[model samples]
Target: MQFTSTPRGARLARRLVSHRLDEWGHPYDSAPNETLTLIAAELAANAIRHGHVCGRDFHVRLIECTSKATTVLRIEVADTRTERFPSLETPTPPTVDDESGRGLFLVSQLADRWCVAPRVGAPGKSVWAELELNHG
Candidate 1:
């Protein structure tokens, strides 16, 4: 899904992702739906806030890759900023009475696996996260 690269775009991304999850049989309040929605909102907001390059907008793609034994939902957010990739191995932010800097930690808890990669065949970066579906 394409977004406007503004605050409204970030909001729309969250809502669109929720709607898509619902369409995929995960209702808005379900565990997976809620987790994806929260991750989408935070990542999209970060893309807009930290990766915006003037009029260039960000894009979000949700994909499900499955085999006989497992299914994974991949959440990818791409932005136009080539140098704004996140460093996951960086040290954690200090916790001395802070009101900010906790998004990635939350993501680490929700996502089974997540990483940032330079966009292949493009000039931007993509932050991708995966959640494993409950197969039981």
Candidate 2:
């Protein structure tokens, strides 16, 4: 999915992710749906706020994978800015008085695995998160 680089777009991306997950057998209220939706919201917001390029929009991709051992859902958000990639090292803790800057921290906490990489065939980068689903 591609969206305009705006707050509304970020919001819509989040909602659509939840809806898509629900359609994929993860109900709206399921842990996987809610968790992946939140991850999408944060990444989309970051792309809009930090990765915004004048006329370019952001792109999001969701993939579900199942194996004998576990099921995983991967969410990727790509933007047209390559110079401002997030730190691959441990995210620095924001000061107590800071009003923001916790998006990636939250992602690191919620996602079983997460990374930022060069956007394939594009002049930008992508941040992706994956969570292992519990079958119970």
Candidate 3:
């Protein structure tokens, strides 16, 4: 799904993810759905705040894997700014006490694995993450 690089876009991404998760059998109140929504919101917000390129929008995709003892949920967010890849540690938010610079930290806490790669056939990068779903 493509989303404009704006706060509205970020909200939309989170909401749509909730919808998709519900369709995938994880209702909005379930752990899986709630987790995915948080991941979507953070990734989408970063895509808008850091990866935005004027009129270009970002794309999100969800891939499910159930073969493992725990299910694997993959979230991919692609944007048009390849140079502004997310940093796992270094966040220069211009100030020490600022409320920013903790997005990836939260992502790390939630996602089992997360990384950024060049967007296939595009001039940007795709920030991808995987969440381990609880089978019980």
Candidate 4:
């Protein structure tokens, strides 16, 4: 899904993710569902805040995969600004009074694994995170 690089768009992306998770058999109140939605919101918000360009939009993709041993939920958010590369190697902790620098911190804490990479054949990058699920 693609959305305008605006706050409203970011909010919509978050809501849609919750709905999609419910449709995929994870209820809205479930841990995986709630955590993934928060992650998606943060990613989308970052794309808008740091990568938005005039007349350009952001993109989001969600996928659920089940292999022989595990099920995983993958979330990806892409933006058109290629110069601003995000690093997941060392996320800084936000100050107690800081209201804004905590998105990636939350993602780092909530997601099992996450990274930012250049988008293929595109003028931008994608931030992706994956959450592992136990089927038992």
TM-score for each model = 0.91, 0.95, 0.89, 0.96
lDDT against the true structure, each candidate: 0.86, 0.94, 0.86, 0.94
The residue-by-residue lDDT of candidate 3 on 18-109, one tens digit each, is: 89889988899998889878989999988998999998999999888897478898899999997887765533434567678777777777
Model 1 scores a TM of 0.91
Residue 135, model 3, lDDT: 68
Clashes of each: 0, 0, 0, 0
Clashing pairs in 1: none
Which lDDT tens digits does candidate 4 get at residues 42-62? 999999999898999999999
- Candidate 2 to native Cα RMSD, angstroms: 1.1
- Clashing residue pairs, candidate 2? none
Q: Which run of 10 residues does model 4 get worst, by summed lDDT?
A: 85-94
Q: Residue 82 in model 3: shift from native, Å?
A: 1.9
Ranking by TM-score: 4, 2, 1, 3
lDDT of 2 by residue, 2-109 (tens): 999999999999998999999989999988998999999999999999999999999999999998778999999999998999999877778899899999998998
In Å, residue 2's CA in model 4 sits off its true spot by 0.6
Model 3 lDDT at residue 85: 73
Residue 77, model 3, lDDT? 93
In angstroms, give how far residue 93 of model 2 lies from its true place: 3.2
